[model samples]
Target: FAAAQLQADKNDVDTRLSQVAETTAAMMDDLKVRPALAEVIKQLIAAGNVVAYLPQDRAPRVYRIDQFVLKRDNYGQFTDIIIQEKVWPSTLPEAVRTALGVKLDPNTDEKQIDVYTVVEQRDGKVTHWQEIEGKEVPGSKSDPIPTDQAGWLAPRWTVVPGSDYGRSHVTEYLGDLLSMDDNYKAITQFAAIASRVVTVVNPNSSLDVAELAAAESGDYIYGEPDTIQTLGLNKSQDFAVIKDVTATIEARVKEAFLVANYRDAERVTAEEIRSQSEELENGLGGTFSVLASELQQPIAARYLYVAAQRKLIPAIPEGIRPKIVTGLAALGRAAEVNRLRTFAADAIQILTPQVFASLVNAPAFLSRLGNEHGVSSLETLLKTEDQMAQEQQQAMAQQAMQAATPAIAEAAIGAATQDPNQGT
Candidate 1:
């Protein structure tokens, strides 16, 4: 009973968290945050650093590295950031435009309004708002929110221990990309030159420049035989060398990016699959840690905050905190499941079924097992006390009929064979 109650409480918490996640996701969709997040990731891989933040509305917005500058505190945390945005007057609400006193001119390109928003730690608390044309804007003004509730999430590929910013695979392999670009340019120029025909002529030779210019394929060049040869640059060897080098660099980049050739086979073994999975998880362990901390944690906290504010979910107890399950934490859960299953197997192996049933608390054991396996409504599957009692009664009645069957059949036969004649 205690075990069942504990599991019930856990399920309730899980249910609330699930509701919060679903609500937050809906808001993200309504705010068009998914596309912005995609762009943030694209920019993160293309460049090195990117930023995403939720501004209480139309969030989370993404900022490329160039669009924002950030500062870190002594604890290597982002304490301040200023993001620049170019907003057209039309995109802004009419009230905001009127408030900003924005004017439009027919001659200029719907001249963009430069908006700068700074979120920074002030007096040990963070505050944020936007500045338009040197004037502060209404809404999103200075109110201190919890750091996690402040709605900032910055995911980097990898970073130095104390650096506020991070570097990426693209940045690491930049040299190869540059070389590929330069080699491609060279090849294009060479191909262009090779495709053209430039005729050489001696000053002493009388050549019709106009005729040559107008000549088609196989047309005669009326000049001294030695002075009319076409110039050509045979760059096949150099082209081959450049291509070989480029191929080498391309292969290296592909391998680093895990786009290398596959380990093809008719069938893959479980061990091999497990090995590959472990390799990927290990290689990306550091990156996943950063995301779990920066991206997942903040999002989870923000979702809870939003849920509470909008009354989408009931007020959560102060004692309960949402945990982002990833990396080692996720593994711990998997390990727990395995250990539970193994324990059950071992108990059954070491003891007979009757012995096991006699010694163990079957209801509690089954409930815990079902909970770990994520199977809900376990009580429905388990037999009720009344049901068990009824089944036991039916089983005993059936056994009694079976045990008396032979004696009853023998008695009937004896009476049938002798009783009629003797009584007459």
Candidate 2:
């Protein structure tokens, strides 16, 4: 349905096009974009910078920071990107083959070609094309796409002012990591030395070195009582110190990466749990925000553009940008659910059930909790306010009928006992 038709009757339009959304989702699943997205996030964290581009003609491509060059406009927005891909010649367009003066070959499957795809916003238009060996490919020129449909996404782990690249968390904890590595190496070498068994021998001893080496634990050697003794590798104390230091360094590094687990006693207080949860949330809050702005919204907008272009969906209304809910914020939302659960539990403990019922909108609370807990079709699962009102009215009517039933029965009995003819 068109936007006007949708706006005129949202329910009907939604019901009609519901299958479109499902089919689109199924199509996206078939494209296997999730694996590409997972790789994009992996690169974002590992390298601190990643570039993902969605071409209407193909699955999204994830490029390493080294594989692409980028330029930001005066306002620090990405304006130009040149990505180099090692593509197979079989995948290239015929125009590209003609430009390269290459004849069709059955062995194209084994061939590799370096192609450069350049996309940039110029003169208020988004232009994109591909080139091989610095010469433009004849069939790879894209018509001027609207800036909003540019389909380029670059999400970074952490932004550095005036720098195009992002800084990874590993770099922030480099000192701790390096120190731990050295400590581990020292501990390992010391452990190897300490674990060795050495039997010291005197020249006066008659025990043969080969015999002594081959002797089992129960074997008896004929030698002077004090002639042969074991020498201790006394590096245990040094090893313990290195081990302790390494553990501490490891903890620090884990803390920096926000992967450290917070453990309490076997029985922990709600407050303690809440505190740890808040700390974790605060740590992820910034990460979630960065991904929402840098990754989520752009992907949603570009997908909407593509869907609209293909008429799989209606054009979006002006000033209504695509807003993603369950993308990067999933982490934050999980935290929020925990927070809400804690709040509800605390409220129940602090107030009587009656008081809690009076103080809170129970239906609203339950609906929110259900949604946060990822309940599907939540709107349909929960009764609407109108439904509640109708239910209340029905209950009242039933109660009134129940109270009036005996009175009506007595009136009918009196009328039957004293008939109209008997009274006359």
Candidate 3:
């Protein structure tokens, strides 16, 4: 019984150890992966590769081609990273090609692709046209080749073509250009969505303050609040979603459009696709700029709020601290006029009498205070008191003239009485 129990205990220990080991390995893998996922994704996008099957007579023909860099990061990540897709209009049956306005090529079964890679120096451009042949063109004389010389290398900006590779007989099927059209649709859709999130900024004081105040009051000012840009916080999932969807679409586009014949398909261009993708990015940037402007509206509001609050709670009464009242009232009025009501509130809330004392002693505010109320100005106040005494003396002289007028009137009446007696 003791031996049996020992064996069971040993088995339990081993199980626990195994579990720990598994957990540790899983954790380490997760730790390494979580941080590197973005880097991996970027690398994959930079290294463009597309593989897709094209439609043929009553079946699907396998075609691989690379056209252009499916723009990912620049265009909110939803813009399809397009590789040029090549389809021989001749590959379809006579009836099908006639209906589709092209003939499907039977011999040219494999597709061609152009891969763009940047040169380390001079920002030079090269194109690695990967066709069915998988051979580097310019006869391996491609300059600034990646040290780990993959099948081929290309400069990022160069417009190039692919090489010929063996054609394969595959199932021919009919489908809409859905696979090709989907990436473009996805990119435009993402751009539209991003535009909605970043509204145009109409700078109006009342509206700006009201909306911000309402938002702060826990009112849902904007539906789909996720669209609103939040600074100092994680980006909205809309952005992330756009990014993710774009990457997926771009990857698929790269697959769908990649061709195996590089040199021959040079006439097929991706300039239109590339330009549209860039426009999408520019649109996103415009939207982001508008959102940024909207976000900053609060700053002005904050300043006004603090200023008003400071004025509301004056350091001294107008009579006792006339200078203080003058200065603070000016600030308060400015805050009110500027709609910086929140800033005024914050300033008042943050400042106390002790804090105010320290702030007043600061060189800038102090200089303004002294310049506002010069020592000579205070002396003028004292001199005005002396003028008050002189004004009093002038008032006494006017009273004496009034008294003499009354006595003169009485003496004239007496003289009139005496003159009447003499006349009788």
Best by lDDT: 1
Q: Name the runs in model 2 displaced over 4 angstroms.
A: 1-31, 56-58, 91-95, 103-111, 123-125, 268-274, 280-289, 307-315, 322-332, 335-351, 355-374, 384-393, 416-424
Displacement of residue 100 (Cα, Å) in model 3 is 85
Q: What are the TM-scores, per candidate, against the unseen true structure?
A: 0.65, 0.79, 0.16
In TM-score terms, candidate 2 sits at 0.79
Candidate 1: residue 347 lDDT (0-100): 85
Pairs that collide in candidate 1 are none
2 versus 3: better lDDT goes to? 2
Candidate 2 local lDDT, 118-208, one digit each (tens) = 9887765788888887788886788897665777787777777787677775666678888888888887777788788888889877878
Q: Give the poorly placed runs of model 1, Cα more than 4 Å off.
A: 1-34, 55-59, 105-109, 122-125, 180-248, 325-424
User: Residue 13 of candidate 3: its Cα lDDT?
Assistant: 43
How many clashes (backbone N, Cα, C below 3 Å) per candidate?
Answer: 0, 0, 69
Every candidate's CA RMSD: 7.4, 5.5, 36.0
Candidate 3 ranges beyond 4 A from true positions: 1-383, 420-424
lDDT of each model, Cα atoms only?
0.74, 0.73, 0.36
lDDT of 3 by residue, 333-364 (tens): 34333344344346657896566555542333
Cα misplacement distance, residue 361 of candidate 3 (Å): 26
